[model samples]
Target: MFGPASSRSRSAWRPRPAPAARPGGVSPRSARRASGSEVRTPGSPPAGPAPRPALPRAAPPRAERTMPQLDSGGGGAGGGDDLGAPDELLAFQDEGEEQDDKSRDSAAGPERDLAELKSSLVNESEGAAGGAGVPGAGAGARGEAEVGAEVSAGPRPAPLARPPPPVPGWPRPALPVPWGTHPSDPSCPGPRAPRPSHPLWISPQALGREHASQRLFPDKLPESLEDGLKAPECASGMYKDTVYSAFNLLMHYPPPSGAGQHPQPQPPLHNKASQPAHSVPQLSPLYEHFSSPHPTPAPADISQKQGVHRPLQTPDLSGFYSLTSGSMGQLPHTVSWPSPPLYPLSPSCGYRQHFPAPTAAPGAPYPRFTHPSLMLGSGVPGHPAAIPHPAIVPPSGKQELQPYDRSLKTQAESKAEKEAKKPTIKKPLNAFMLYMKEMRAKVIAECTLKESAAINQILGRRWHALSREEQAKYYELARKERQLHMQLYPGWSARDNYGKKKRRSREKHQESNTGGKRNAFGTYPEKAAAPAQFLPMTVL
Candidate 1:
């Protein structure tokens, strides 16, 4: 009871005809043609001359064919056809000739076409060298030299010289110019020195965007300038010495040449701030002590007697001698002074000006400061007017101590107080802890495990199983977190969080409770849905 479909399936299976009998001993499948005089079946009459076998067409000449790429030793076993052969340079040279032919029809000028061809050839040479950096540059230069020599030596007539067409937007790639080479004749066909290639063409809009971004975020400074900017103290100290030396010269005036007698007691000032800056004030009694010949113990001796190891810093008294006509021997025995200047100012009868005086009308002097944070008082931090003496010697000397207030604080003390007020920073998670935090819930969902200990064990195995590249992500995240933590709390340390009580886990707290009031059902009302759990500091 075969249906129509079954009958059609049976008809579809037809016997394949026996492979056409091999005609005249020739393979039926091969492209070879039989003789023109085809033989008929043995006993039958021969048919009219069989259509003449068509002859195979000849291949085009190699010169007219496109050249194949040369193998640059980078080819593998599969690239047997790419192996470079003799006259390979001719292939590249021919390619340039082809470009020359196209350039004849193009709107571009001959010089530009020639330059482009030269650059293309040079880039090819560099590519063949596997990006050999400096050596590749040399190869490109040599390729350009060969191209120039070929153009000059060949019998082909030169292309008529014409000015290059103007490029309105993005310009064509420029030829490589060696370091220190003159740009006056870039197009001249001469052997150029080695240099890196110009970057590939970029859209004018992209270049403009890049330039705008550069203006917004300026490029990083050179290593030398960067180091100087980072350590401002060193630069400030240098300028401080210069200004300090100038002030020392202006403030110090040696007494008349004799022992024990002091300069006429300076006129007392009503208010120094009220005096016009143009009119020099009399030397303050503070610096007057510096001019005195009293033999006070050197700071070194005083610090030693007190068992302190502080480095001794004496006032630079060399500038004082420049204002006086005296020798070092006439000064106090215990005084330590700096070496005399190479060009000392002539002993001035009146006053010497180290720099031009300000022309601004009488007003307060411009406030001088290093760190703005240090401008907490009216007196400058390092100004000589604020100190009792140029040198900080112990109170053992006859000079009376100045009045002091215990309330005023120093910059260091203020900074400490601010830091004490800041809230403490929590420790950042490590790579493993971060990984567990992210994957712990996922693992719990998949494994149906409520116990965190079991879930963590699974995550630990998964963490180890992860490829190095995958784990590196967590490591990088952890590193960035630590960096942010350091910036937020520079003085924070792990020890600060140590020995502190940790909050009890929800499960632990539930177990600790005796029991919660049960609903009508004889069970503790599913302990008031415990509040959201806190993240654990450690993996377990």
Candidate 2:
């Protein structure tokens, strides 16, 4: 009678047996019998029986006993109690019906919901994958959203396409090159090659710009002449041309018409309005003193003013006449003849007829008297106004001859007087004779004094009693003095004829005094003569 359905029902409701004993050897059944349960019955099934025993009084199955343990372990004590109660059994049956209803609802809608969830998960994964490629995905999404909003308001334009990736080995887009510059790439436009820095033409533009920026603000500009010409903002092409034109005009053109000329008129005087208030007129002390209202000048002022006019200086008339006169103590005179008788009216004489009067007109005397022609003229005689003849006349009461005529007469008289006086006087003594006379006298006096002194010294020396050495020294000193005097004044050794005569006379007298005796030195007795001394002895 164990149909599949009934068996399933019984299995579900069965109580569990006690745990089997472990391998160590205790039996749970025996333990249970010992704890006051029945141990055995006469028709009980064996322990190893294939079929289970029949229930007593229709009790629940043994498996049903394990349900509380399972429920308690899985759920709690309340779950164990619920598993044992009939009401819980009914609630569980209702719970099963509710679960069936939920399963049915899930089955009915699961295909569309699962598909929607799978699509959302796929979109998230793809967006995350795209995040690796895009640099700012969130920002891009925000931008897209904004663009969508714009589109909703009106038709949207397409986003601009990104530029193509830079090609390898190709040059990147170069910055704009300045004028006269070549790009890093040789083929680029402008200059064909990079220019080396030129020493002479080196540009100061960069350095100048830096200096200009530091020194000049918006209002003030550089004051340098070059800077003004080169300023980029100035009128184009005008600066260089204007400067060159100015230079050329300065170099080539004539100076301005009024240049270096005196000014035509004085500058207009400044009016009171034109003058600054702080300026005051400055008057020099001299000007102020002169302009003051003083009636009389001071003595110092008069003296200062006197310096303006100096006395006129006159030439020396005596010195002028002396210089003009040809001979000493003479002056020239001229006389006009009626026309020299036989040599009548030569052309030169006719020329003299028209000559201006020698004295000039009464109001205008001749400027100078010493004319060359007037000094050469010959003149008439006897008239008081005429030039006197050299042979003249009366001693008394005669007017003095003209200076030139008088000079001639004086020269003739001087010659006559000189010839007449010449025979009366004897010839004059010459310098050589005078010199001989003077020298002879001097030599005689000196020789006499020196000879006397030597004699006295020799006699006084006690010659008979003296040693040879003492006598020799005295003699040597005398000899040296004589030699020195002769060397120093060679002119004193009188050698002329007069000197010789005087010496001879002295020698004769000396011979007489010595009675014609010759001394041991084979010389006559020495005459008294002075010791010779050098002239101009002060220097020594």
* Candidate with the greatest lDDT versus the true structure: 1
- Which residue runs does candidate 1 get wrong by more than 4 Å? 1-424, 502-540
TM-score computed on alpha carbons, candidate 2? 0.10
Off by over 4 Å in 2: 1-461, 491-540
What lDDT, from 0 to 1, does candidate 1 have? Answer: 0.24
* Model 2 lDDT per residue over 444-514, tens place: 12222222222222122112111112122222222222222222222322221122222443344334544
TM-score, each model? 0.17, 0.10
TM-score top scorer: 1
Please give the distance, in angstroms, between residue 143's alpha carbon in candidate 1 and its true position after superposition.
69
Q: Write the per-residue lDDT of candidate 1 for residues 382-461, one digit (tens) a residue.
A: 32222211111212222221222212324426765634322222355555665554444334333333345434543543
Task: Give the count of colliding residue pairs in each prediction.
Answer: 0, 22
lDDT against the true structure, each candidate:
0.24, 0.19
